[model samples]
Target: MDVDFRSGCPIAATLDLVGDRWTLVILRDMLNGKSRYSHFLDSPERITTNVLADRLAKMEAAGLVTATLYSKRPPRREYRLTAKGRDLRPTVQAMCRWANTHIPGTWTPPADFMADKPG
Candidate 1:
């Protein structure tokens, strides 16, 4: 369930935008250099086609990602993170580190990816 915005809280606002199960996963994919729709579809999370389309649209609407046409023949589009989205790197890295330590058998993120830099 999403929290209704009743207070002037930054965390609440941010969560309202990205607190869903799939949004962060999509962002993680983009940070890992995935841009194409098919590439996102192929992620281990196995997001469905309808859910992928909806989440991509929502992310684009939130100004975290930009979609560009890569192929006109088949109407292919590629998604990339904007500066705002890239700003989420530290948060993501923090979560990765926490998960690696708290959760057993979870793979640690690559050193380069967690180097406190923009995605």
Candidate 2:
């Protein structure tokens, strides 16, 4: 299915592709080195299997992620971010910084965490 963009603006175009909470969460997990299905499923946030599966497929279709079969016997697949997905690190970091600054709590990410990392 084809999904039309929200507007001609670059940021709007990007949100059209990678928008939605689950999609962004999945991308964040992938950026942090969570590739396996179980790793994503076992996250403390507890995303449902169907939602995870849908997000993975959508990300793959959008060229943000690649699915690879790590096991030949059972044909198990793992998801990894492509260059397009990796390029979104700045957007994610910017969102996190904004949240940290605007939100009520004085929440600060770890030193080595991506939110604190240099672009």
Candidate 3:
């Protein structure tokens, strides 16, 4: 991914990579053990197929996830987070914490999920 960083700021550069609307959500789904394409489609946010495809490709290009071919006839692949991607666990957890604290009606995440140590 030949990214043009908007600035030298860490947050801005980080956002340049994963700041998009669907990236974090997809990361959250992966952290929650959703790896297959169909599993991602089952997410509550209802991400469209095209968007999902684009995100997965971009993530793979960015080295956050690895796509392994699981089926030859159907040409299906399974995605797994790399160590770089797993490092975002705390970020996702922090978001969950903020939401549960400040956003009314937000569902509290499972205890295990909230307590899991970042890789």
Candidate 4:
């Protein structure tokens, strides 16, 4: 929606939305089929609950993900990536490629994940 972008630069604007330390990591997890809050918490990154909550809210606000109510008693929601978010698949894949090539000790993603076409 109405993002207070720092400049008109495309890269800057994108970075503004996702350049934070945890957003991309969270995005990666989502792409890997982790949607529930507990699932995100189960990531090896060990993101704190507060930060995870904030990131999910920000992602929903950015139209990158949609939150759907899945439970009522204690009230819980599951998140699914919108087209905008799924579009980042190639970016993540590229990052993985780069890491696997340039970085030491980086594990390769599953073949299916690397082969999946980005939206």
Candidate 5:
């Protein structure tokens, strides 16, 4: 998909791909080790199957995630973070930290989640 940038700003460019509420959540799930489609469905946020499928496809197209065949009989797949996806770790971590400090009910993300290594 051709991204028509509104400006040359880097933030605007990044937002063009991941500004939506669900995209970041999907990325966070991948970071947290939810590799299978079923695992994503089990998230507490309860993302609909259709939306999850769409976001996963889009992320794949954008080089963020890659789906590999894990089950042949059921034709199931598991996703992994590409280097581009791992690059979003800091952005996700910053958002989590901000929420933990500013949002009254928000809990801090685990230390490992913010670690450099992908789970």
Candidate 6:
């Protein structure tokens, strides 16, 4: 399968990879050390199981995340961010900061929410 490009712009190309709404949320959760499905489900947005599964599959295909089996009894899997995915931290952080500043709200994340980590 091939990607359908919206435009020749690099931003559009980048979004083609991480464009889906669920994908970014999944990435955000992974950045915050959320590795398990249950933990992802406990997130503020409360993603549905089917959507979560689909997003995981897509992320895995895009080399953004990797899944490892943590259990054999029920065949459970845990996901972690790959180096490529970790590189998205800056983009996500910038977007979050922009939203916080432009969008009207008294909400703010913790000081270390976007700390300098060697990812």
Best by TM-score: 3
| Full ranking by lDDT | 3, 4, 5, 1, 6, 2
Q: Which residue pairs collide in model 5, if any?
A: none
TM-score for predicted model 1 compared with the true structure: 0.91
RMSD of each: 2.9, 2.6, 1.5, 1.6, 1.6, 2.1
Q: What TM-score, to 2 decimals, does candidate 3 have?
A: 0.95
| lDDT by residue (tens digit), candidate 6, 7-83 | 89999978988898788988988887889999999998889999999888888887888999999999899999999
lDDT of 6 at 30: 89
The estimated TM-scores of all candidates read: 0.91, 0.84, 0.95, 0.94, 0.90, 0.88
| Each prediction's whole-model lDDT (CA) | 0.88, 0.82, 0.92, 0.91, 0.88, 0.86
What is the model-wide C-alpha lDDT for candidate 3? 0.92
Residue lDDT tens for model 2, 1-119: 36588789987887788878788888878877789899999777799999998989988988899999999997778898889888888888777789988997845655455554533
List the pairs of residues colliding in candidate 2. Answer: none
Worst 10 residues of 2 by lDDT: 110-119
lDDT of 1 by residue, 1-119 (tens): 23366567888888888889999999988998899999999998899999999998988988999999989998999999999988888888889989998999998877878877643
Off by over 4 Å in 2: 105-107, 115-119
10 residues in a row with least lDDT, candidate 3: 110-119
**Top candidate when judged by lDDT against the true structure:** 3
Angstrom error of the Cα, residue 105, model 2: value is 4.3
Residue range 57-88, candidate 3, lDDT tens digits: 98998889999999999899999999999999
Clashing residue pairs, backbone N/CA/C < 3 A, model 3 = none
